[model samples]
Target chain A: MNILVCISHVPDTTAKINFTADGSALDPAGVQFVINPYDEFGLTKALHIKEAQGATITVLNVGGPETEPTLRKALAIGADQAVRINATPTDAITVAKSIKNHIQANAYDLIICGQESIDYNGQQVPAMLAALLDVPMVNACVGLTIDGSTATAKAEIDGGHATYTANLPMVIGGKKGLVEEKDLRIPNMRGIMTARTKPLSVEEGLSGSNTAAKAFRKPAAKSAVKMVAPDQVNELVRLLHEESKSI
Target chain B: MILVFVESWNNQFKKASFEAVSYARKWADMAGCSVKAVVSSGASNPESLAQYGADSIATLDLAATGPGMAGQLSTMMDGVQGVVVAGTAVGKTLAPTLAALIDGALSTNTTSTPSSVGPVVVERGAFSSKGIETIALSEGMPIVSFVPNAIGIEEKAGAGAIESGSASGTDKVAVSEVSVASGKVALPEAEVVVSAGRGLKGPENWGMIEELAEVLGAATACSKPVSDIGWRPHSEHVGQTGIQVNPNLYIAIGISGAIQHLAGVSASKTIVAINTDPEAPFFKAADYGIVGDAFDVVPRLIEELRAFKAAN
Candidate 1:
């Protein structure tokens, strides 16, 4: 079986978010970039499938050359090959379109991606790709298992989890329960060396919809926390009900 | 007409659906358009939406369509100017697909209502809720999925005529059964949330959390470690890799805030952290802090909440 895993380049979750001087774009000056944490979960799941089911894993990302290090990291984590769609991903729709075009050219039995990227948090690409490619998809899947050509996935909803079944050539938007953090593979010295020589290819992508961001601003700074002693817990309740009007 | 997808499960309108209705109603009033609703489920209560500004409700018998409601939504988006949906799991799937099908723009987890900022625009969290990004739809209709609790739900009586329909054909994928936590407030729609981390030590100590949540009418959540160890359901895990919530009030019990955890909840209107260690990172992000033991503090906190409720 052939598996495709899509990853995104995002600022570290702990990075300080800042807007440009004119407040039109994100200021990348002091931010440290890393593979989106959710995408890491998807990549780990793909590697697990590769190990257990003997599938070739190909990692894909639509980004500029700056995303190569993240792609190499996926290779080190055990992807068979890496393909970079040399395009500045504007929005989820365009990104999914590029992915759909790529997947149409090179077929895959399964496609995996995070529920949403940490940066934009649109949570749209997986669904859009599935719709564009006319394939079945499971959103926010927590547990996934592939038995031959049949795939059964467990996805948690508002109150309970839904069990879904679909054939191969499907898409899954994965969350935490799909793969545990402890199962993530770190690049060893040998794996890093091998990643340097791994097959990395770049391809042009389709220019699709342009969803633009007008401006960006940081969230309002949190005020100093109101300290309430353990015995004065009721005061906190009073504050919530009366002052904040939240209760 | 402004179209809003009323999200229902098991034929019941979820709280987020009402929120979506109220949100659309406000925007529609501004746009001088009627508010129309579409429900894919066998909605138990279609008339309830009428009081919340729905002029008409289109109920679709999507039982045969399975979980993929995008086709039905695409058909419903016809002749609609602005589309509003609750940013729940189902809406997240349908809105994007509809946006793509219409060659329009889509914005999820909107922190505020879409307004005309030289074009249709919506404010949504970016970079894991650390910042807010104002997105403009380049052209075509705008599909906006509002985050729960961001827009207040209000009542305004309107015509509420129900029209029934169904998807033309079946979908490729099929959901065998929908497993939802019965009788509990869903995390996404909850206005108040009380989340526990490993600080509580074990699942057996969850009684107070449940009691507090019950008294306050809030939802219960947990940290990644708590869920990974089977202490809580994975559905209740809130973090960057888990469910991101924007509740009005978020209380953390025994959970030292990790960056991943904070990423999911920083957009909350107010945060209260109760941890034994005052230096826990969650304090920096919280509006209130109580440095104490959960065993001693949680029960007392529950008692205080009960007393406050009784007084009110």
Candidate 2:
């Protein structure tokens, strides 16, 4: 089977969020970028599948040259090839369409992506890609197993979880439940050495609807904390009811 | 007309559905349009949406599950100026599919009704919920999914006339239900969350936490360390890297408030922190703080909450 894993390069989750001088974009100064945790989970799952079933895994991203290092990291983690759709990804719709263009040129038996990127959290690209491909998709997929042309997937729902059975040429949007954090692989010395010679290709892409960020601002600042004594349960409840009106 | 996609799970209309409908109804009032609710099949109590601003309701035929469901929703786009969806698993799937089908701009985690509708301006969570990004869509239909619990449920009477929508044929895939509820509230949909950290000692000590959560009608959540060490399932983990929740009230007990954890829970409306360490960083970010031991404080909290509920 052939698998394509989509990854996003986002700011490290621990990085302090700040905006540019004009508030049009994120201030990259003093920020560290890493693979979106969700996407990393998906990539790690694909590696598990590849190791077991002998599938060729390819890592794909729709970003500029700056994202190549992220792609390289995926390659080091065991992907056979990496493809970069050379464009500044504007929104999920456009990014999905662009990835669809790449998929149209080359087919894959299975596609895996994070439920949503940590930065934008749109949760659209994977669904959009499946829609554009007109294939069945399982979002928030936790457990997945492939048997020949069939795939069994389990996903999270509002109250509980649901299981889905779809054939090949389907999409799976993976999340934290798909794999534990400890399962995430770090690049070994040999893997990193081999990554330098691995295939990393870029292609021009199509664009769809553009949903640009008009402005950015921090969430409302919090007021000073009202510290209560340990025995102030009654007062705390009163404050929650009267002051915050949140009870 | 504004189309509000009402999602259901486990044979009931999710609370998020009504929240989204109410969200769209307010937007419709501002935009000078009517609200048309299209609900999925098997969602019980479809008419109750009338209480939450659904002027008319349309249900997808029972057989419309996969691509057929998408096509059925597409057929409802005749006069839809914009689309509203809840920020649930189902909405995340339908939002982008609808955007692709309509060739429209889509925004998820939208915080409010349109401030003004001409350009369709709205705010969405950004940077792992640390910031808000205002997005404006000029052309085509604006497809937006509301952040769960961000815009609290509001009610305004509506007609709620039910109608049947078209259903395309089935597909090759077969989807089935796996497990039902664990008798606990879902984390994202919870208005109040009782979250803990490793400071609680172990998974065996969760009885008090569960008792407090039960009394408060809140979901239970954990910090990354708790889930990492297997004290809690990954689904219960809340942090920058895990589920980011924006509930109305979030109570963090035995948590020291890592930067990553704060980034996720900071979007909550009100926060209360309880920890033995007075210097724990969570206190700075919390609206209220208590320096106490969980074993002592949690039971007291549960008792206080139960009594408070009885009184109120």
Candidate 3:
């Protein structure tokens, strides 16, 4: 089986997010980069499927050279090969188009990606990919299993859950409960050394008008904390109604 | 016309769907147009959408078809200027796919109105709820998915016209199935949530947490470490990578609030924390804090809740 896993390079979750001077884009200085956490779930799930069924996992990314490290990390985590679309990943449309162009010639059995990237939280690329390919897609899948040519997956729905079944050549987005942490593979030292010798191809990004960040600004600061004594329930309610008006 | 995706489960409209319809209605009013709601299930009562300000409702008999929500919604996006959906997992999944199918731009988890311009501008959450961002979509209709529970629902009386639609059933690809746990409230839909962390000691002590949750009609959650160690299922993990929730009241027990965990619940209306450590990080983010052991404080709190319920 052949699988394509989408990956994105995002700032580490612990990094303090800040804007550049003039507030146009993300301030990259002092920001540590990492594979998006949600995407890690996709990569690990792909690796698990590959190990279980002898599938080949290909990692795809839409970013500049800065994202090569993320691709290498996927390689270290067990992807057989990687493809990097050389671009800044300006918006979801551009990224999706680049992916579509690259995969148009190849037929994939399964396409996996994170539900959303932590940095922008756009949550559009996988869906966009599925639409562009005209294939079935499921997002935020919490569980998945294969039965012959059919794949059964559990996707998170509002207030409940839904089970979906799609044939081969479908897309899925990863979320928690879909893949356990123990399933994550850390490439051995030899695998890390072998990754340098593996194929990591870079393709030209599609040319298109991309959305530009006009300005960046910080959110309004929260007010000082107010203390309410445990016995002052009535007072709290009165204050919420009269002063806070948030009730 | 503005299109709203009315989310439903077990033939009931979700609370978030009401907000979605309200938002679409408000936008339609601003745009000098009408709002239409689309449901995947024909079994749904379209007339009820009128009370929530939907000018019309469209239902597709696809409940028994499959889980190709994006494919089904895409066929119905004709003559629509804008699309609004609840930014739940399903919405987050389908909205982008729909946008891509239409070759449009999308904004996720938006919290405020879009700016009127050639290219639409929308405000959305960023930096794990630490900031808000205004993004501009320069091409096609903007597909906006609003965060669940962020927008308040408002009712307006109107006789919304109902329409039925059909589409050719497509072959299923990548079939999916779910086995829901019995007697457990889905964390996302719960009004109250009781969560614990490593401070709880072991899975054996989860009975206290369950008891508190049961008494309050709440769901149970665990911190990342707790879930990582198998004390709780990954479905109950609340953090950046896990399920983010914004319930009316959230109670954290025996947990030191990590920044990741706080990001998930900081949007909640009210938060209370109980931990043996006076300086647990959760206290700083909590609306109320009690410095005590869960072994001592949980039973008392449960008793107080029971007394309060009985008295009321």
Q: Write down the lDDT of every candidate, Cα atoms only.
A: 0.85, 0.86, 0.77
Lowest summed lDDT across 10 adjacent residues in model 2 chain B is found at B62-71
- Tens digit per residue, CA lDDT, model 2, B17-88: 889999989989998888999876677888999999888998876433434455567767888888888887
DockQ (0 to 1) for model 2: 0.74
Off by over 4 Å in 3: A146-149, A158-163, A209-212, A224-247, B40-44, B63-67, B115-118, B168-171, B174-176, B181-184, B310-312
In CAPRI terms, where does candidate 1 land? medium
Ranked by TM-score, the better of candidates 1 and 3 is 1
Query: TM-score, chain A, per candidate?
Result: 0.97, 0.97, 0.94
Model 3 alpha-carbon miss at residue B63, Å: 5.3
- Residue lDDT tens for model 1, B75-145: 76656888898887777777887777777788887988867733677799888888899998777778888
Residue B164 miss distance in model 3 (angstroms): 2.9
Summarize candidate 3's per-residue lDDT along A1-247 as a digit string, tens digits: 8889999898888877789777777888999998888888888888778777779889999988888988998898788999999987878888898998888877789888888787877778887888788787777788888766778888776445678777878888887666877776677998788788778999999866435456666665444445554444444344434564433
Sort candidate 2 into its docking category.
medium
Total clashing pairs for each candidate? 7, 0, 16
Per residue, candidate 1 scores C-alpha lDDT tens digits across A80-133 of 899999898888888898999889999899999998888988999988888888
> Candidate 2 lDDT, tens digit per residue, A49-162?
888888999999999998999999999989999999998887777889899989888989999999888888888888788888988888888899999989999888766778
Please name the candidate that would achieve the greatest lDDT relative to the true structure: 2
Error of 1 at B155 (Å): 1.4
